[model samples]
Target: MNAKPRISILFVCLGNICRSPLAEGVFRSVVTEHGRAADFMIGSAGTGAWHVGNPPDPRSIDIARRFGVDISHQRARQVEAADFNRYDLLLGMDRNNVQTLRQRAAGGTLGKIHLFLDYANDRVIDIPDPYYGGEDGFASVYQMIREASEALLSKFD
Candidate 1:
């Protein structure tokens, strides 16, 4: 196998308790399933500090667990300036989150900031925020992130 790229990805949402943690968990699972766990470093954070140090929402954990990905251990945290340096890609769940990311993405890191769906292009796309809806919402979010992650991994590999 080709040596894996030393890539780091940071998933961001408004509150780390929902979308971002799920993205981290889902993306990590994808890399692990392909035996490329050591190829990348995956992490997540919220643009807001409201849920700092808190575990993902119970709804998120339950939904992720049902899909065979455990997100319970992940704690919510606010994005820091250093993350712009730490990650190769700083992907946001949506456009609004992109605005938040841009504020913290000082220096030349703006090039790394992108909408999560941007990678998927016309295929499976748009990492949605499932905070306001039902179980189906979480499932939809997970599916989108999974598909996008797959598309992204293909490019890197």
Candidate 2:
């Protein structure tokens, strides 16, 4: 018998250390909670190269930990041309990140890229960048991602 194919997803943002890593962690937690973790492959990246090779921001890691998810292991990475082919879905945290991915995409690869909140049933259109903000900002971002992650996962059910 053949095994089912795993769906690959990549979350993206301006810098991988913040929103994208949180999104990755939240989504992973949701999937694992529902016993669907093995059915999917999840990861994250950024549109910029600044944070490459570093782990998720301390603030992001702390916020995720508060929610019982550990994102400390996730490292920053710049979105690459090859990623379009590697991931089935490439979710951007905001408009600028989506635009950057669109500009880098070749041909039909652009179709797989979308705003992370696009899957959300609510009216939230973008996941705000919380890099320059205080701890409360990270908390807000975590809530947004947690809600969207649940909505996004519901689509596959």
Candidate 3:
């Protein structure tokens, strides 16, 4: 039997430590829960390099942990030009990040980049950054990412 091709996805944000990491973790958990872990490649990165070589923010780690997902081992990385060619989808947490990805991607790669929430919330096309907010903000962002993950997975599996 022939094996199915994987659906590779990369999540991006201003800083890799917050929204993008959470989206990566939540989407991984969703794929696993759906028994489709072997069907996908999931990762997170930042448009900016400020937090490269770091882990997700403490609050992001905590929020993911509370939901039974451990994201502590994931490191922050910068979005590189090669990423556009490697992943099937490059999703950004907000309009700015989406715009940045589109601008960085070559012409033919444009179709693969989009706002992360566009899969789940067409009206509020973003998963807000929780790095500067309190605990509640992380919680809300986690919920948003989780819902979007499910919605996005629906398209592939």
Candidate 4:
């Protein structure tokens, strides 16, 4: 019998320590809840190199934890050329990240990069970064990510 293929996804933002990590954690939680975790390979990265080795922002971690998801283990990483070929989908948190990814992508790789909220049914197109905002900002981001994650998972069905 032929083995099943896994769908690979990469979430991206300005810095891996914020929105992208939250997206990764939320999406992972959704897939696992649906019992489809093994059917997909998930990861996250950022467009900038500043936080490449740091953990997700403490605010992001706390917000995820409140939602029953743990993102503390995720370390920040900058988007790499190899990632274009590795993931079937490269989800950007905002238009700027998508534009940056497009610039870095080789000819055919551009097709794999897209805005994460494009999958969401809501009118919101961008997930604002809460890195320098208050706790409420993190909570708001959590809701947006959770909604988008659910909508994105529906595409796989």
* Global Cα RMSD, each model: 2.2, 1.5, 1.5, 1.7
Estimate, for each residue in 47-149, the C-alpha lDDT of model 4 and write its tens digit.
9999989999999999999989999999999999999999999999999999999999999988898899985554548899998889999999899999989
Candidate 3, residues 61-128, lDDT tens digits: the string is 99999999999999999999999999999999999999999889999999999887885556556677
lDDT of each: 0.87, 0.90, 0.90, 0.92
- Give the TM-scores of the predictions, in the order they appear: 0.92, 0.95, 0.95, 0.95
Best by lDDT: 4
How badly does each model clash, as a count of residue pairs? Answer: 0, 0, 0, 0
Error of 4 at 135 (Å): 0.6
Q: What is the lDDT of candidate 3?
A: 0.90
Clash pairs for candidate 1 = none
lDDT at 6, model 2: 72
* lDDT (Cα, tens digit) per residue for candidate 2, span 1-157: 2165478899999989999999999999999999898888899999999999999999999999998999888889999889999999999999899899999998889889888897455454888899999999999999989999999989888
By summed lDDT, the worst window of 10 consecutive residues in model 4 runs over 1-10
Q: At residue 40, what lDDT does model 1 achieve?
A: 92
- Which is better, 1 or 4, measured by lDDT? 4
Instruction: Name the regions of candidate 2 deviating beyond 4 angstroms.
Output: 1-5, 122-124
For TM-score, candidate 1 versus 3, the one ahead is 3
Candidate 1, residues 1-157: lDDT per residue as tens digits? 5476589999999999988898899889999999988889899999999999999999999988988999999999999989999899998888889888987778698999988888545442456678889988988888777888787778777
Which ten-residue region of model 3 has the weakest summed lDDT? Answer: 119-128
